[model samples]
Target: MGLIVLRPTRATCVSLACFVVTILCLVSNGPCRAQLSSTFYDKKCSTALGTIQTAVRTAVSSERRMAASLMRVHFHDCFVQGCDASVLLDDTSSSPGEKSAFQNLGSLRGFEVIDSVKSKVEDVCPGVVSCADLLAVVARDASVAVGGPTWTVKLGRRDSMSASQSLAESNLPRATDDLDDLISLFRSKGLNSKEMVALSGSHTIGQAQCITFRPRIYNETNIDDGFASTRRRRCSFTDGDSNLAPLDLVTPNSFDSNYFKNLIQKKGLLTTDQALFNGGSTDDFVTEYSEDRSAFYRDFALAMIKMGDIDPLTGSSGQAQLSSTFYDKTCPRALSTIRADVRRAISREHRMAASLMRLHFHDCFVQGCDASVLLDDTSSSPGEKSAFQNLGSLRGFEVIDSVKSRVQEVCPGVVSCADILAVAARDASVAVGGPTWTVKLGRRDSTSASQSLAESNLPGATDDLNDLISLFRSKGLNSKEMVALSGSHTIGQAQCVTFRQRIYNETNIDAGFARTRKRRCPFNNGDSNLAALDLVTPNSFDNNYFKNLIQKKGLLTTDQVLFNGGSTDGFVTEYSKDRSAFYRDFALAMIKMGDIDPLTGSSGQIRRNCRVAN
Candidate 1:
């Protein structure tokens, strides 16, 4: 499906505000409903609601059956494990998911529609909206697509990391369940008989497979004779098990009270559907809904609201909703403050730009951009700063301290050291000639640091091709990203100790380049001597690093391996020829690298000092 861009009008905003107020008032009676808010994303991602609505409308317009399919997907998600989005997970070798259960294997549909909406939202705002909340809003938009009632969807639900096929098999209602069985299943999910009857009305708009209704029509006595004859013509005893038939014969594709009306005429397609009105406890409610269409719409909307509120992960339970506008309201001048300080530091020393950027990369690789690298070495804990890779080599600690001090002057305790390091990295890139990207905020600083992990996780300069690829892969980056991110070396400098063996013994290096490097860095002396990583335009961030590799002028063993007739040689050639392609991929890789195992929400705290935890 294609993305539909929508801008909200003034009247639409007013109407949505009024509806949000009404929903808040209605849900205020209970404590469970207070965990979510109707306006949770009003400031975080303003275009999220409109984007989801447009995407759902486009999908349903392409195929009218997708409306009911979307609604059913939401229902199935909420029923199993309390709307945590466990149903959307695909079954892996280690984790068997809900989608492969006997109840949902071939019955579930509209997964691609949800996936499309997620991609569109991530384009506008990444790491902000959860899949669980997306399902809730998609169900509302799908209802309005096909003459169904709409309700305000309370947000702030988080996605589950695990899925349970056993829970799906036991918790979901079956096609052949009687009235007592249906009531008990709904009751297990905290829904009453009235709400169960209201939710059952969703079958009016979707078609059912013949396997689900064959026994109900052929052997059941409660079904209408004419309806049974019509159904039996398509579904035989042994064949045509997957043949399709509508649940409501009157209006199959409209979300009306026709499903309830069909029950009164003994035309409910599934055995569990006809059991509602076959001299059961739900017969009176079914009769009332068939007579009053407005009543069915009202109860259905209310039931949907209740179902969406089932056991959601709210507050500090799940991952924090990171947004680009996270500090807009709290500290309006946060980005500018960081940008100004970073530029001043770069002006004093051009190499400081590369230093600050390297600090971010090292901090993220070790402990997920938590500023653990900035922590001073204490007697009790060695911290990452004293690790073998960063003992006396890493610089720009005072620059980060200066930036954090200035940020604290504007908004104390609201800004995180982790977020400050991330923004500083972006600003340092832009200070020189580098591509800029939006930095997702809301990461918290780690209270503790690990010396052992830092020693193990950080990549070494002498690493071979396979070792380099494996190190980057451990942090969720591919070989292409590894090559693109290595472009940061286009502006930095490597010490003599890091690359001495490459120039002295390696045959891949150019003879002239090795002779020039040996003049500054001898074979065994001047281990602390510095040499530019890129021989041409060492201060600018460009694709010259890749170009140098093509000429066999790479300064480090890891650098030369990227173009040493390996799997990454094509990427090196492509980047050497195209500067814009390198910049774009580098920026995307930076953003992806910043998201590695972040300490978000309440998992970590905002440090008062960059050197010490609060």
Candidate 2:
């Protein structure tokens, strides 16, 4: 009944023996794990952890499996190269990536969610947040999302410049691994048998593919007969190899000790899982965890923190900036220069406020907040500025260029054009009587732009309410956020052609409002004519946009559809009555929208000119 060591390599066996000796020495004396601090980012980015938690909670709420997926991402990253974000690297022609390795390709998920978290962190602190640190925080949050223990994740880890497929293939544990091999793998990384048992409890929430456990279910004698039969119903020999079965059938989505309990019952899904309980040295540890959820939670948290501490770059050792004061102390006048230029532009033209806000949205939505929207058309590449949705729709390019010029004069190459856009959009909202929030600094700019991408991403005025919802939902914005962000129409205008069909052909339009619009927008002739989106308070930022929707006076077809017996009607009605609620939610939605994927760290460069790459 005792578990035996499978075919382990000579190197792995020697490494495990060394780790065991090290652990024994540490146990006789005391443990020594350091170099990462929990408060590492407290001053530099106070809201960093909270922001990542919110995103993780939101994503997990939408899909419970996202918790397991995100956890896998952290595990994969740590196993490959000491939690340095090597797994996130994409495969290039010259270098192979870890994402396609044997252990990662079909199993790992949540890269987009990580990218989303990275963007939010960047918006507040910009280049200050490291993708590696972001991954650790996200992993902790994902655990909490699944009703697991919350841990203080030490930060300041930096991203690796390259990934290793070979490392991932060799390091990541397989489902078919034996107990000794699994223990050796964890021990080699400085974790004990108890910690390995607790970490394995994470499988309580996730699922395993049929192919991974088909051998165990059909061929193994250690498995429970009933459990194996139940799994066999869904899995076949040749077909259904890709079918999925929960690791903890008792509560598939809850992060608890149920996985250990299942192993105690001989119902574990994978060979590696059951091997822990097969009269091995780790068997008592597994039994302790199965009987006490608190012990499991505590051990898991410590193990995760230990895993995060492996080979960390630590304070100022890597590309990680320990402080967000980089530009504040280095440039001194960088932010003030951009702010002054933004305020001056908004003072001269009120419409530029809305234009600036739209510019940020356009820039973020296409290729992250890299200021790619500011690039003009060139003979080599027709930039996003002239795309279908941006040709005449987007504005504030001159304002961006002017601000970049002033910032360059004050501190050349210090303030990035991307940061200027993010700051200018925030300043513009405040200039027009909107709620003000602090914008995080340190973003860089992109060298290239995409016209085809812009046309595909930017929503059109003629799009229906469903289209609007789908567009925003694709960017991880829920229905409520979409409604709140659409309120930005209060200070903007729409062209006649954009809404001419609504005025002439749509029945949902208010008769009086349609008649009023038709005066200047007659059928097909005045396609170029303009009309204020929020007629009641065209020059102000308020709840009038939602109120107009309630009255069927919305300028575009997309606007009217929000209130015309649709999913968004309730939000429109709610915003119409409570101005404070509208403002609060609108501000929050803007922050979320501004957090689209962004180029951070050394991925992109700060451009000298807003209109062209440096």
Candidate 3:
């Protein structure tokens, strides 16, 4: 019932999801954080978190603004070097520190607070906890110190050995960044547009120096006149650059969604903040969050979890590791073993190819292809299997199970379930008449799953073109790629309940086609009845889905909306005529989809069983 934001799974760092944007920041070279347990120190150092919490609470008690300052320090530290307390380092005789970096100079504070927490923690358990992990906990507690949502901070991350000033200069988003640049910055770290917009809501409780917003208030065209004039009183172009202004004009000390509401009224404090609502892809979500504070809070918590998960040195001593290769020295036959099993499964049941491909989308869209969708329900807690969007609609779990079994025989515990699903999806596409592209391997499986996330993130059959676009756009997929990916409908079938409304009530449907569909899918109820998504060449992987849409024969309303006189109509028309264009774009789009935030290196575990954790 809530707004479901599609969090893209991380792909192998070969290339980013190529979006047509103003700027593209290449993904940082490092393994991302995963497999972190909230109770990581429950046994080793039980009082570790509580000790830090007490210290943080004491610091914030003296100054309410310290909460916001501490939060910013964590964000800046993570953005530069995986939140290893690198930003807390001071300039020494040997090397320059990140504190002197252009983005952090005279901006970052609250280092003494972290030092105090670390001193107390070291006395209780010396070197048992890492600075990187402690910072994550402090960030969560700081949010709750104000009025923001709370989340469990995953532990066991190690501190970085080195820091990069240049990386901070390139990676950290500027206050004057446009929407595209802001999106690229976060996407490079495996977060999405909705997360970017939600995370920006943190500006609600922070203050910005006049130097950060002077240009926007003085020169930007989209700003509200009265709002800009009021801001200029505290900040002047010639002299008051160091003077401070609240990032959110209304209730600047609160942690609500008022920042988004300010954006709607053209009162956003920074250019990057206003850029979210200025006729861009992130506009609708901004409007949604402005009206619904709970939605904003929910998404903000998710974003913090995601941001905290960026490129932690997991299971290692704070070092960047090489990515997984199909033909690795240790796992020589990994790729071949997966390829053989997937071929056998698809050869046995041809329909399983389409089913497997759809399964990959379902897995990746929810929580980054960690095989969480393949999980069956247990007594402890539910999985994604019973979600409204998944329930009985998703198929091909058996094929992935079979592949994992065979893969285990060849290389026990060497291949991860996350990697298996990626390889299977690629091989499944090849089994059908689809294009062949390289599949990036070496993704680890997640220990937990979320049914609520599955329900919110998955696309619905009744979604309009705008909703469809927004859904894909949340994962950095543009309209062209979305239209091309919808070509998957060319090979699948839908239930009668899914398309019954289109046949009976929709005016754009073809007359004869509607009449034919009405026989099986009636006016009243035949919800479980089945209908092929593409009538012409139903099992073929081609442009027929678009061709059918051109004739108003798309089985679901979401599918037909592609050719229903919208911005995406031209893409549908082009693909319907040119098969090669569709194939090329589809392959690229699949690679991009596969690249959604993945669990790489030692971040996640290699589950022996696809359905349950090892």
Candidate 4:
């Protein structure tokens, strides 16, 4: 049967509202395990939104539809003031079109879901986290939160005090994209075509305004006559005059590859969809992604994982906010129980070590599925400095002091410091795009901190892929994983300062790509040195980095290598062509990477902070 494109009205929004209710109803969990996926989609913020939309779509009367439409909001307001759910307000003074515009921005609506997740976590662990940081975590978690898929989302993102209406308009790609234009837009954000395609797959869910596709629906003068005629009936030519409809009704809220199929038969109603098939690198990507939704889904996930590794906070980053929910801040009554658990964990010893290792795997895998492990450092932002120094004075030991203090008050040293640190790291990394790396079990905690070790071992922002690869190979990591790990550039941001060399100097770059960047770079003398890694899709998980490199738009010299015809060149092309292959390989590589140099089985003591191996 031909597909039905649903144009949400006063009443249809109600059904959409039910989407949230149904999703929330499905989520339930126990203490030990998390049914995080169930409540992910049906969140209050989304439901309330769905209710308004449903009413608008289903309204049988004009007055009713107008009243419901009055309730519609925009991305500008929702994200303007911390995504606090105030964007839904409808005032008589406001223009009806303005209200509709806000409600129509479903692609930018994920922040609301993140806000809800933070609220739940805040309820359990108050003042322990900032909504900004949770927004980053929940962005990744929302995917997992809805049982969609997992990828690392780095922790420590600060919420922007303002949303740039101009920038969002300039940066956010349209539903209509041709490969060239899409590539250009991602490039503006410092992302490549590969990540562009991967990120575009985000159309797997979320709703779009019919106006966005008016050109494709009615004016595709070059398309098949029958296809164009049918689309026009559903979408009018009036610019900015539109209706709300999901990209994929089959799996309206699930992250998948149906969007790709829509493109295959020229069903692509967006300029963006038709752009991929305009016959370029994106065409290959579309072909591959279309053949296997699993591949698209998986690679979409792995690319997300690799992209998460981009410009991440590590060892001593103190700029971002750290969530305190992962800490053991129990009262006196709970201390005893905590200590008992600690003691039991300590007694199992090997089992505890293994358990720590198991949990570490989830952090980075949630984004790009890469396992880039680091010592548990409690500090916010990025640096070689450890964030857990206060732990020592807070208790008697550094890493375990906080845990011990709380545990002592409640269960009294029952929980091992190592176990606590392991759990905290997983939570923190997942908050960003970090993955759980394999740790050698049973490492004893060091009473002292190691500044020298962190500097020597941790990867830096300035390091090229070779420098990073060398560091990994020294630790026995394979080349494939090394290249795969670089994909982390998809999520985090890098200071342009880190890429000035490749952008301006020919010392370490391909002549053509470097020169172009040098000319386009407005601040090579200053800002160039400050360009960051994950500029493109910094909040998304995708393989667009690979696409960016092909365009000479890559910001870092190290970033360009994956596609610069090197040994790992195959990885670049392969990843671009097959999202599934990238997904599986990246997953394996991440788990393996996490395994490197781990403090397993009494080799080293587990420190409470991940930054310090001591």
Candidate 5:
């Protein structure tokens, strides 16, 4: 006996059990060197395709009807603003986005599914995978999940920074369109009549709302009488406008030539669906597709490939300069060598993990992770190493030097000191059992250091909540990101001088915790004595720092201020309860911080020694 698996349907598929067949009909013939490639992210983010596939399959398996909605999202996104993910943006005060456009408001679904896939991809390769490429891949995976023909997805598409509601309203095809209208719309997008007929076969799976097909059932003479009556049972003149019915009456969840078959029998649900066979120029193509499913699949694949080629951004266009695989070919062992060194260093001294992580944070806060913090003081100008905030507190220079020396041995002058710092910070986090995020490479070392920027930008241990928030804000971070990044204190320590006044003078602190801390950090003496930032688990990276904040056990004034009934207090409480949430947000925040103004693309030279310029 065969096992049966029950798959849930999306609430949007209620009663309708059908899917919409919107066409991505753009095309460019002759194939004169495609801008996008199937192997675009092969080295940059190897797991990106697999991650998208898993997320799409999981979503479709949970809600069998979501396959069509996911595919429709890609069509809608591509038609408006050239498949740059403009449809995915929510409306803001400055610009009304495509989500609220007439065709997409309530008709479109499966946005949450795309959001879930993006989050999963971001986890493995943060700042590496573009949302535009994710939509394209998700569309393909959704088709395969429902026993549909698969196609190669050309990647390296970058997401748009803005969306357009007017463009969506003008560009998207309407269900009320007739044969000429549909053909003209496809023609405007560069698709011919035959490609239009093939692409419309996507109606084989998905549901359509009553509002879309009501006029066809009530007034259209080309539609079948029995089909109209069946549709009219649920769709009235004005009521049940949101109710749904399948586009393909026979197999709504499977992809095949059933839509073409329905068109031939005059049972097409939408006016546009019936227009194909109402003695129009596209009638012969529709008849051909209905008879041969293999022919339908072949043309559909070709049409989709053409649609995906519409105005895609590739190479250096509309993308950030940094990439995760910057050294994949030049220095294949760069990341591995750095990771191994970080692990050995952490194993020898666990505190080294926190030091390395903090080193990256401090470097980015000042001059944007350009390795300026590693520079020794020169005769001409002092470096960030001599800044007041980093003077005697900063550590891990030797660890960075050791890693740089080892990397130089294998691929001399190929890996930059700045890129090594970013990778090492991620490796250190994993070594200490914290979250790991991908680090975008291609950052070059700064020729000079700015002690003044380091002193002003880096947050102080004695800073108040407002001061901390403002400092982070200047570095392109919000209060929530500030709170998440501060969670890094879960594994580090503060010197006596930094927290002495907080232990002795602060009233919000726990008395017992203060007394224990004061034992090693005496007043006016032992200024260099250290106390664990997270007293419970000082050597492990977790959410205990937020827990300590809740109990007034935070070692630094800045740490306690995060949970002191301020704007960020809620974040502290939430992290204290959910460690996973804290880790996820922390990893994202780290990637954002790593993007703060950096030297890349011929702006700076790669240094042989991390402590000085080449």
Candidate 6:
């Protein structure tokens, strides 16, 4: 007879079945990358990334390196669709990180600096560059603008010719997600549920804005008082609409595993984040990540590589540029050799993408995102990069630095930094063979990336699938992809503010989840504004979240919808039935979501760089 493995059902009922056999095994050997350690990258790419990090450090007063790092984090998040650099852009226009202008600023504010640098580079070099290389350089430079740490970067990438708003919407994850959906999203990107949990560990470093967690604190009254009080001081929710959170709270100024501990308690900032431990087959992995901070870091590095592995430039075909602008837009007849070189470079770019896709699958399946391969001393110090007390360990110019290095080597005086930043993101997504998106070139770079832009571009911590779907739709993503990406929440932490809403407003939610939420998220009578999102399993990464809904214990109304009602019920059930199956679907979906409208032969020139399309 075939063996039958029992799937954990109820968040409370699931015996620590511990299906996750300690995911940290990814780090058992050491740096997972090709022996590339943080030290190595710093030494190799620092020159290119230096300026960006400097800009990041300079951008903020209290936490320079942290701010810089934050920019890098944001950039990484936003690149799959367009390298508008919205990730680095925060809601700086407002202290609360939530303002009308924050979301409305558009692409203009986020990537202005890169444009300026590109224009300057153009004067010195011209068309001899590619956008990908420019992005590498500017990412580092942008980090510097915000007061961030410095790192080394390599260049030699090309640009895309178009941009797609659709892929961004469908591919990105929502703030409120469950284990099943989260796993699905990673699977789409060639990732698995365990890795999803590991990557969620990033919350250990950033801070959730008050707006994002207000729902958890104000709506759900049953919560750890101390946890709610500490976060409540960040904002006010009189209007009943606030969505924000600091990516990290424990070592808010640095990047570390404190977020895992936050999950252990009900202190996570987003309802989606808190869902990790709601009860399910994946919880063991969360425990493992929490137990070993080093393991989390190692995995995180590997996951980053996987994320970066997307669409890369391959051999001889992807003719990389020194900057966004390649030298001589009109090719000379005698330049056949150089043109052939460009063609070969472009082909290489495609090959690189295929390679990245393969790596992504490995990262996703082998051990999830604990991309131990990326770990080699990649850790940064707050003092050297950005201060952790305020900003966290994020840096700037994450990719631009690499682009600049590549462009400068070949063309010298022909590329623009602006295009590099833009193109690199496109190529990166493509490298992972993520969804193909359209990228338009000729974008002028600015000297700054706004905090407001970053806040606006990203989804809020409290957003449900609908809210997330809306955000993604605006970016041109499909409902299917929207549903798929929501799964990222399965692993991350949710701030109390974001989770409070569902717990308190019983009248607003679907009945099934509303009844159980009272127990999981309690709202006090006197101070309805003070509450929390989850009572149990706030940090364990598993599918118990679905089981919670089965029992009406879902903290957020949106979460309950995964099982009890709405279009997501089937998906939730399927995910619960078999974790591996969910992982497969999620990986494919991610690939589609990432490809919004990829450029093809003559769709545009094989960009000399990624930031700018040819």
Q: What lDDT score belongs to each candidate, Candidate 1 first?
A: 0.80, 0.74, 0.75, 0.41, 0.79, 0.41
Error of 3 at 442 (Å): 2.4
Off by over 4 Å in 3: 1-314, 317-349, 408-413, 465-470, 473-478, 563-570, 602-608
Among residues 3 or more apart in sequence or in different chains, the pairs in candidate 2 whose N, CA or C atoms overlap within 3 Å are: 124-440
Per-residue lDDT of model 3, residues 180-298, tens digit only: 66765576556789998888888888788999899999999999999999999999878887898988778877788888889999998889888999999999999999999999989
* Per-residue lDDT of model 6, residues 1-614, tens digit only: 00001111111111223222111101112111112222432433344334443443444444433443344443344334322222322333222111112322231133444444444444544443333444544544443343222344444332332222233434555555556556545554445566677667655544444545677776764356787776666666674244344655556655556667777676767766777766677767777877886677667555544444333221122111122223347222212332233334435443332222222222222212112111112133111112111123122232334545455566553443433333443344333323333333332222112232223334444555655444445344455544444443343233334456665654545465455444534554322222223334332223444445556665555555555566666766666666555545555555433322222111123323323322
Highest TM-score against the true fold, candidate: 3
Give lDDT tens digits, candidate 5, residues 476-537: 56689889999999997778999999999999999999999999999889988988898889
RMSD of each: 18.9, 19.7, 9.9, 19.4, 20.9, 21.8
Could you tell me the lDDT of residue 55 within candidate 3? 89
Model 2, global lDDT: 0.74
TM for every model, in the order presented, reads 0.53, 0.52, 0.62, 0.36, 0.50, 0.41
* Top of the candidates by lDDT: 1
Candidate 4 residues lying further than 4 Å off, grouped into runs, are 1-115, 136-147, 175-177, 188-190, 222-224, 238-240, 249-254, 306-614
Clashing pairs in 3: 9-596, 9-597, 10-596, 10-597, 10-598, 11-595, 78-83
What's model 4's TM-score? 0.36
Report RMSD for candidate 5. Answer: 20.9
Judged by lDDT relative to the true structure, which candidate is superior, 4 or 6?
A: 4
